[model samples]
Target: MLSIAITGANSGIGLRAAQALATAGHHVLALCRDPDRGRAALADINAHATHPAGLIEADLSIPDSIKAAADQITHTVGHLDVLINNAAVFDQTVREPRFTADGHELFWATNHLGPFLLTAHLSPLLAAADRPRVINVASKGLLSMPRIRIRFDQLDDPSWYTPTRAYYHAKLAQVMTTLSLAEKAEGHLETTCVRVPAVRLDPDRVAAMPRLLRTLYAPKNRMAVPAERLGETYARLATRAGSLPGPYVDENLRPVRAPASAYDRAARERLWSLSQTATGDPAWAW
Candidate 1:
């Protein structure tokens, strides 16, 4: 069985994916930020799993926390065959831009730099595995914003900040980085960016929303795909043998063309360089 690690596994897509992977008999490591929630998720995952699941508490927004969690994973599971960078912060209700302790914008730090650094830290363990895979996540919502580009000059600037803009900008960075890593890996490992569509929210979360907000979201919620279905796609990406269809794919594992910006080699290289500087330049295995 493959050894897999999934970030933000305490709920939603990450939680369901962890359960599905563990049930499939793979050794699953569910990385969560909150210890209490991590343990709770562990119980639920273990209840349905053939192979017991493990938890490593990690706050991806903090570099130190990510490093500590990586160290823990190194001790707990000697090597990891798959690393799923699934954790993200996308609260549409957030009005003003928030900054981390390190002064970077919250969404850019948590959604992009966190995964980039985590992958770098775990590269050695990944390289040790027979077929190492790094799975990055994107959004199908990006299709609507066909001309969006990574605002390198104003990534952390608050003047142009909005919740939706911040989220998709970071996702676009993820997609570009996926292509960059795949090229630089030089056959040492494989990288793919999953273009996730709108996932249905849990009933409890929906019910808790304010009445007007709930009413506004009701139509979209009804059209959203079930979380379990996307979770299964994550499982397949982690475990499926042989070549993937492409670097960017839909939930069905079919190739989906990435944005024109993702193909700009110069831009991708610049992003890679910027990410390395942001994350303190962790040594990559490939």
Candidate 2:
């Protein structure tokens, strides 16, 4: 069985993917931040899993939690066939910016910096796999923002924050990070970013949202695919035979180029450098 680890596996696409992968007989590490929710998800997955699944609790918004989880995975699993950096926060309905425990902006910390550090620390375990893959879940929403780049200076400044704008920038950062990893790992890793389409949320949850948010997200939901469908796509990418290099792939698994800014070599390197400092791991090469 392929040993795989998926972050944010407690709900939405991440949970669906974990269940699907487990039912397909892979040994999955369902990484989640909440203990109660994680155990519930574990029970749900184990119910039908061909191979038993396990859980790892770590809040991706905190660097220490991410580091500890990586260590746990290394000690427990030893080797990994796939690492899916699938956790993300989209505060589309929030009026103010939320900060992580480290005081970094919530969206940037959870969506970009945390995943970058987790993947870097776990590189050795991934290398042990005969043909390991790293799948980063990006967004098609990023394609619409042609002018927005990583605003390194204003990441923590909430005065100008808009939920969608913050989410867009964070997702773009993830795309660029995927490119950076693809370049640095070259022969050692096959990394790819998947542009997951918008997904329809549970009806009750959608109903609980504010009217403005409900209206704003409804159009996207109408076009949104089921979370499980996207989950299946993630599974295919993990175990697929051929290499899918780090070009961003659409929901259909066709390569789609991100905005030109994401491909800027200098910008990518700059982001990588800033990310090392932001994550507080100066010794992390590449």
Candidate 3:
């Protein structure tokens, strides 16, 4: 059975993917930030799960936590066949320039840098596998932002921000960054970016609103559904014929050109260099 490591497995798409993987009998390491939530999620999945599972506590927004979690995964799991960069943050509705303790742009920290560092530190483990895959959950939102250029100074002085901008920026970075990694790996490893549609699937968030409103508006829930229904695509990247490398995929598992700007090789490199600086771990060598 393939050994898989998934971040943000406590809820949303991560949780669903973990569940699907467990039922299919692959060992799943559910990485979460909260121990309590981790244990509960573990229990929920374990009750009827086809495969055994374990939990590793790691807060995506914290660099130190990510490092500790990576160390623990390396020590315990030995290596992984699949690494799903699934954790994310979109809690605010307004433009807000935020930062983690490490002083990274908030969305960039959780959605981009956290996964980049985790992949960097854990790449050896992934490389050790026969045919490994790195699946990054990206979004179609990259199309909306007319102004997206990774400013190295954004780390130094994050100017006015918005929830819309942050979410779009975070996801866009994932797409571009994944492309960069694919280029760097030179096909040594299979890396694919899945462009999920916008969705919501939250209990409280949905219950508070009118049924028609929920159906017509958010439609997904506290978590997004259409964006997530294709969680299987992530599993496909590992378990099925979805192993095509270096392409941004759509909900139907087809390749898509996310945005003309996302293909900028120079910007991709700048983002990579800045990521190396923020995370303190150099990008992996093929």
Query: By lDDT, who's the top model here?
Result: 1
Q: Number of clashes in model 2?
A: 0
- True lDDT of residue 98, candidate 1: 97
Minimum summed lDDT over a 10-residue window in model 2 is located at 277-286
Worst 10 residues of 1 by lDDT: 201-210
Report the lDDT of model 2 for residue 121: 83
State the lDDT of candidate 2 residue by residue for 250-269, as single tens digits. 87788888877888999999
Per-residue lDDT for 110-197 in model 1, tens only?
9999999999999999999999999999999999999999998998999999999999999999999999998999988888999999
Please give the CA lDDT of all the candidate structures: 0.93, 0.85, 0.78
Distance from true position, residue 59, model 3, in Å?
0.9
The residue-by-residue lDDT of candidate 3 on 205-237, one tens digit each, is: 455556666566653344455424766767777
Each model's TM-score? 0.98, 0.94, 0.89
How do the candidates rank by lDDT, highest first?
Answer: 1, 2, 3
- Scanning candidate 3 in windows of ten residues, the lowest lDDT window is 219-228
Q: How high a TM-score does candidate 2 get?
A: 0.94
